[model samples]
Target chain A: MTSPSVPAAPTLTPALGRKLHPWPVRIMHWTNAMAMIVLIGSGWGIYDDSVIFHFIYFPQWARIGSWAAESLLWHFAAMWVLAINGFVYLTYGVFTGRLRERMLPIRISDVIHTVQDTLRFKIAHEDLTVYNAVQKLLYIVVIFAGISQVITGIAVWKPIQFSGLAEVLGGFQGARLLHFLGMAVITGFLIVHVALSLLVPSTLWAMLAGGPRLKTPKLEAAE
Target chain B: MRSPNRPATPPDAAILDNHRAEIRMLERRGILRGTLSLGSLAMLTGCDISDDTSIGKALRAMSSFNDFVQAKIFDPNHLAPEYPASMVLKPPRFNAYYEIEKIRPIDGPNWTLAVSGLVNDKQAWTREKIATLPQREMIIRHICVEGWDYIGQWSGVPLRTFLEAVGADLNAKYVSFQTADDYPSSIDMATALHPQTLLATKYAGETLADPFGYPLRLRTSTKLGFKNPKWITAIEVSNTYMPGYWEKLGFNWQSGI
Candidate 1:
């Protein structure tokens, strides 16, 4: 077996998009999904313990780890998983050119058209291998949100050690606020992404089982 | 990330192996069996598939790893930022496990800092005696693990100076403090020797209030506010790991910022 990101002039062709969700991508995606769920739930628990906005509070059932201390454990542990998983995903994206080919060069006109199609209830799902403009935009924004969340999280976690990062990110309070906002953005993305996947169950299958295969296959080489 | 799978549709053998691998992992972890909706997906992912004592153990291990990381990254010379006098909060915000009305008042003049454990000089020093030591004042942020912080001026002898003066085993694993408030907290040797760690007797140029750490209190820049024990009674330098009040109740013992 070869590394998913490497250009192997061999099995599992990308032509029919059979290589859409390689094992690494699939594993990391699922792992990160679980990690994000844990992080978000436990983070909410921690926030509720000593709330930033006193009036706003997350319900207990939606939270992980019975209390704030336990929540912190879940949060920190999940944070490591997220960090490692994210780093791997990023490396894979860059090295394999998946990020450039699938998620870049987003044009305003394309975004507008995608929105128009969605509004008219004419959403297209003909090509499961490729991302729509809206999908690309959403993915890009959430990636930024994830990056910001991690940065602010570290700053809040150790303001004294990462003093400059804390200061730049707005100290203790500001870093927390940014982190909170990042969670909101990611949560929103999850709702949309999940709903879309469920709406077109084929996308879910694509992620789960590598979707469709070509009748006549060539050695998968091209990234 | 897992290695590339050869076929678009995995064969029955691969499927069976994946299931076997998942079960093996769960058995290896000794995790409590629960009806996990996505158990297969969560396998080998370093995530808790269900709520159980197993996750708790995993988290405790992570906390210990973090403690190691904290110590590894700690710099002896790096000082926590000092604030201006204007930034110092006069009559700083009060926080204790108990209520303000329940503050155990102490007679400041009669207070003696009893030193014990791994020290050449185990004599008790009175408030007057500590006052005579070289004083270093700093205005640093007092941060709470609860996510609030305050800049307050604390003036007292540096802990490094006091530890050396007392002929303490500077290499001791822990420096523990027992407060009159019945709160006990301890810090690592590295943090104890940090230039900003102070046996602060005064706040904002005046002696600490009775509700605060009157007579004497441990003020550390790098630790959580709870680590700063108030209304001190005794200091012990020990090689043993002595978990403090909150620490025993599940807070990280090395509660460094």
Candidate 2:
């Protein structure tokens, strides 16, 4: 009962110091978030220059670069930061095994249960250190989306140079649409993540400073 | 489905307020993040940081870095995709910085391609003299920075051959074009020498349309559409950077495809 993180994560709890995000994790998370914001806003600006869809339009307010050229500059500049930071995060997460420990072994049953409970306004977030199946799925999906954005972005940006990648994405126009889709998914994730953090303020506090040092979760072993 | 360790309560207003206060009291790191995110939010509502002098400078610097990278990555021998002659568009889309009415059609009979700058032979070229040079044709995608694309067939002397014939300094950093329409543009030396680079005289086997550079235009498959200035007036082989018409207006100078 002393190992109190999830359905069971005995091997990870103490090693991870689950109450606090590691310094590298915290640093990379904030930096990645900032760069993502810049990328999304600038991307909107560039898309507006010659929109792929006639019906879809983003107002000037929703854009970063005032002009198409300036938007491209901002987009490229932020891309390097996002890419380098993402690479570091991936290396750290994989090498340290944090990605596996925190977000692996998702069961479909658990996901269904979580969804049913969420619809009924029942959340099992008593432990900030543990992620439900839904949470794990979301984190993994967002990471994949981020990687896909980079790939598709390169395809459109240099369709001739990266012809194979463009072909993979169904050519130049296809690459642009896929990149936009990635942005939409990430935006959706951002909304849900922020909302959840508000619902569980302690989790936000924990992210900022390690949570209350629980000597034990009233050990289930005590009967 | 509450766990045995559950708090048995939802977060209250007091908790939210306390965390808000704590966030406000955090050190410079938190404040900096707050300001940045706030600025991002402000940007979403029409804040124009692009107009800021410092930010403009930073964006310009980034564009220059992109140019540097594009130059480094450009493989001289890598040809842009060539289309079949059948794929070439008839009456290709005409595009220029100005309206159709503003097209300054070159007076072909009076036209002479004045060559200057770093060149061994400064002799100007006439349409009749250029006609005598070996002619080659290519069908390549004309990709515009505004996101449209067209495939067109252009016939002309390969720019490399013409440069050699004119004794232009091939080693020069740039070959700038001043067009009859006053739309000046320049390309990198590597692109200038690319096999697809042409001093185009005809489009789709017909002499150029008045609106599409009647006498001669510079066409390079390696660069964006705007870099291919129409209605050529002068050619300068130079070591110095010559500001292009669009580049002066914030478009990246090295607009390599």
Candidate 3:
């Protein structure tokens, strides 16, 4: 009753799955996901509140909150999370060479081949450790899209304080347009991403658990 | 390419008209298809945007709900930050529904600001009378609903002073303004009483140019540029709600920064 005994370390077992995602990447991934959901929902609420596009009216049910003020509160609150998490993700990715290691060495021919392979329904399921050329390209595009959204968002939020930035984006109206387009593009990516995840359920499981559940060929061979 | 010598004929005109009709048909199909998707989504939510009246009502309800939330959080004592004089944009950009050239020149001498509604002193205020009131100046950013902003140096009598001088019922729910340019707008009593709310008579140390509101204009640092009605002609204090020019057109009524 006085002191609890420390348990001995268990015997090492052979590795099963490859480490597809590090802890930081997985944590930031989920945080970014939550932030994106709030941002998009509240953003739609704001759009309905002041509707820049007359032709397209997003359904009221899709709104994040009942009121514009409420939506704005949610939006700004989520914005801070997204910005900080994105900054950390980018910095870590760059410094640790993870970005270059996982997403780079992508060639034009590789992209062309990936597209052909995808269209032919012949995407190889063997390699979960590395992103396909198309996936890498999409990830790169999403990174730029996120950056653009943040810039345009700042321009719209504090036009007076960041007048130069707004001007660079072709003034406030231009920034608003760009911001909306970025959201649409991100939404498109999210749809495709979810669909792809459904196709390979392990990818989602790997992201959630931080490693693949099944042993890779290399790991099995090593054992 | 047609032969240079060939004369344009009725059959050719018929063919052209047929082509035009086909294009119109295609355009209509595209629009119909887009609306069909939207209508189906609306149906899923049990809110039909197909009917104009119901959609308008829904939008209005949402807007009013926003107004209530904004009013609940509004702080009368909170002041918008005053920018440095150096931040003031020279030749502040002209903004309005119409072009600058179309601005109707108001006769400054004949212009009398009529005050009405829940006020005890419903006197017609003249430019001379307004100029006599204690003046205040500040360089503040003018944020527009369209998303642009510009810092401007504005000098005028504090709106609170004008309201007190006129014996306005500070307890009233709202204060409305009618501009000479046919724009009608209102602010919440809390915002109206805010210290930064100004009955601006000068811009950039000079009398307001025609492009800007001339003679007299409401310049509040707390609200958007559209909320600051240019060439203000009348002021009314009321307990009831009144929508402004842009507010009537779906912009947020409580458009605080």
- When superposed on Cα atoms, how far off is each prediction in RMSD? 11.0, 12.1, 13.3
Compared with the true structure, what per-residue lDDT tens digits does model 3 show for residues B1-257?
88977776635566767699898978876665456333322322222212354334444565567577567656667666677888889888888878988899789999999999999999999999998899999887787764456789999999999999999999998999999899999999888888888999888899998878899999987677888999999999999888887765556688665
lDDT tens per residue, model 1, B29-48: 55433434323223323333
Chain A TM value for model 1: 0.87
DockQ of model 1, rounded to 2 decimals: 0.19
Ranking by DockQ, best first? Answer: 1, 2, 3
Ranking by TM-score: 1, 2, 3
Clashing residue pairs in candidate 3 are: none
In model 2, the fraction of reference contacts reproduced equals: 0.32
Interface RMSD of 3: 8.2
Show pairs that collide, candidate 2.
Answer: A61-B44
Candidate 1 Cα errors over 4 Å, as ranges: A1-17, A213-223, B1-52
Clashes of each: 0, 1, 0
- Kindly report the docking quality category of candidate 1: incorrect
Q: Give the per-residue lDDT digits (tens) of candidate 3, residues A116-143.
A: 9999999876667768889999999888
